[model samples]
Target: MSNPGEIAAVIRAVLEALPVDALRAANTAAGESAERIAAATEGTGHDAPREALAHIAEGIERTGEALAGLGEIRERLNAYLAVLVPGVEAMVARPIAGPAGKRPITPPNRRHHLNSVGRKSQVREENTVILPGTDVRGDLDAIRRGEAAWLPDRDRCLVNGRLYGVEVPGTVYPDEGPGLVKLNRSEYKALKGLIEARGDMDSLPSALANNPAVTGADWQRAAEVYEHHKDYRSEDT
Candidate 1:
């Protein structure tokens, strides 16, 4: 005899046990593609194409929402199944042991290094040329000074904390021209002093403005480190 409740439980268990990393990644890509197309077409005479792309982005968003909804449904089913069956979660989560008596053919690091396919697949430098315009250095300097951020926004990196013209030439885009990349030294003294004094992020604005070399990117990276090591401060208080 077959049971609908039992069938639902199996499905729920499978949903809970499976990873959604790839699905979430694909959805994020689709959304970004839509954003790029929209940004590229803004103020141009391409309303129809832009509208279509916007629709496609909406569809991708809906699909992601549906996947999240499915996860919620799985939770409900698991609750129902828990009442129907005992130790079901444990049974579903049981680990499968690797094959016994199988000795290593190569050391892990050596095997990874010797992966010929991986080596060939690595991205090789195609070309490099200087990206002119005093703006680029200015932006990086601002970022170093905590006055600018280079965080991701769709297909573009927000330049100098500018709210508009996000897709213009010389702005940070993944593709197209920007020519050669020059590494700029980050000034971390001001932010470093604040950290040494055990100051939180609340009072960083004035300190950052004073230090032109210590940029916004430096502040962001510092914030992440502080978050991870915050317990050290907590222990003192």
Candidate 2:
């Protein structure tokens, strides 16, 4: 019912508002963006060079094992004792035992463990001193080499109640057990008084060292042992 001029004008207005290929162009651009993102993610993947990483890990493990072996060797070396018998060559290396006794035992690692055990046994032995039987000579020897203390209490002598002073073998404490030798209440009190009086613990006499007798080198060893056993009193004391 409208005139041709009016109808043409409405058609042109509708066509002008619609853009050609705009939706298709938008979809193409979106697809390209998605593809680019996928490519970037694949390129950044950490899956390459796994063999190199594995090799690095293997090297680290080998290094750790080697270090552990060196540590064992060091421990053995520190605890090794010189050959006491004259003309005997010092052990160049710890001896190793072989299976079925058929193979020659010369493995250093085995010797190292044996030496470690022997060192511990020696220390344990040094901690105990038999009284009365230990004799004056023994007492002097213990003072020089062992962790020895004397409880000369008249009433508490291991043998006769003669109450004569005798140095007995006793553990240094904390590190060493009370063992066969012990300090009586009176002895403990005396020792406490002496140590407390001194400003420097090293000034205390060598007899007071964990041992009654000690070699010259034993002085340093005695100081280290007593420093840990500073709380001298037994529970009852």
Candidate 3:
């Protein structure tokens, strides 16, 4: 017999225990390395240096995406705890502590990185190409300056003369939309393992039996994982 209260406590502990700061530090180190590589290879015409820089850039982007996903999980987990374990949300809301005696690095603005994907170079100076006649121009300017946030109700709009889209706050995908289930990395691996064992995602169960990694995960999570896995394969292939 499992207690929901106890389970919630365990979840809170694990979330707090995550080494988010360490991951950020590593990502910062990689970004610095990339900068050096880019500077050194400016006109050398060397393939190796450019290749290395590309790999570093891809890694930095992936790490940023993973951090964004973890943040979403933390927020949702806190909301879940608020209902089952009362007051835990407030306690967990405090920023997680980092390594002792180390000054935390300020993370770069991720708004462009999140949407750029392979289009990293397009993340140029903010407002460098504003659309002259769009209704959302004011909104875009505010968002770019960090003075305001994009409204959840807002959809595709022009920013800097380019069409852009926003992921609505708290928007949960319906097995075919953007991946937003609360499953962590290990649980995601477990779900992938199950799919492989079954030889296809169509045969996977809604939930993993007897697996604590996915105690609170459900069908939507399984579907999203399968979709994302396939998408990754297709894009890489």
Candidate 4:
């Protein structure tokens, strides 16, 4: 993790690099042109300034949109860095454990309930349901068929043999719809690896080190690096 001071400094550099005054100036010019066009139109039916003002407004709107997009990109970048920096720090400080310590972080424990189209009484009353291993085959089929829906608003579910949850919106459920579902701890770790690897493979080591469960001589190397250079920063080019 970056030291708080280093993060602050990077944020300051980002702000300093933004053209706040330029945007303000564009907005001001647009506003002035609009007012002038409005006044000119009051006296004459044909005002050349009206067309100019329209063009100015268009330019201002385009500039505003561009700035908004830049802001969003910057926000997302900052969030990504926040996750990455801490992960890198952890990796550098810790020794690498064998595959045993390499797992995804478990999400917070949340209660999950089943949602049935029929009477609630027909549903299982147990807070936790362990599906039989033999049943896994059929359950997987049912999930493929979209019969069993995972409700994220409620508790997690063991659909088929897999766990699923609706922690984030737009995550496709087994029902072929959008909802969150829980996954087995191992399955979750695998999925996380797939997602993280999509972006950067190098980041994986750091991410693994961040997990508190990671221990042993392997983790010691990461710990040492994190301890020494957690606050290191690079100038933006």
Question: How would you encode candidate 1's per-residue C-alpha lDDT over 1-237 as one tens digit per residue?
Answer: 268666756766576655444444455456456556767888898669767875765665455455455455556766766766655663232121111012211111211111111212222232111222324445333222222212235332222222111322223322222322222223233324445445555555565546676678756644443333332265456
81: Cα error in model 3, Å: 0.7
Which pairs of residues have clashing backbones in candidate 1? 129-180, 143-215, 143-216, 144-214, 144-215, 145-214, 145-215, 146-215, 146-216
TM-score result, candidate 1: 0.32
Cα-lDDT of candidate 2: 0.30
Cα lDDT for residue 81, candidate 4: 55
**Please, what are the lDDT tens digits per residue for candidate 2 over residues 69-181?**
54344344333322122242333322111120123212122211211222122232223222222233332222222112212222111111111122233211211112223
lDDT of 3 by residue, 1-237 (tens): 279878887887878876556555555566556656777779998899988977875675566556556666777877777888766544443232221112222322232221212212332212111112323434333223222211123232211212334333321111111122334444444444444534244444545344465544543454444444323343244
lDDT of 4 by residue, 1-237 (tens): 457757755764665566644554454445455555666677676757667756765665566555555456556656655574653321111111111113322322222222111112221212222211223335333333222223233332333223443334323223211222323333333223323333233556565536554444423432222222223232341
TM-score of 3: 0.40
Better of 2 and 4 by TM-score: 4
Better of 3 and 4 by TM-score: 3
Query: Which candidate achieves the best lDDT against the true structure?
Result: 3
Q: lDDT for model 1, on a 0 to 1 scale?
A: 0.40
What's the residue-level lDDT of 212 in candidate 4? 53
**Cα distance off (Å), candidate 2, residue 216:** 75
Report lDDT (Cα) of residue 233, candidate 3: 43
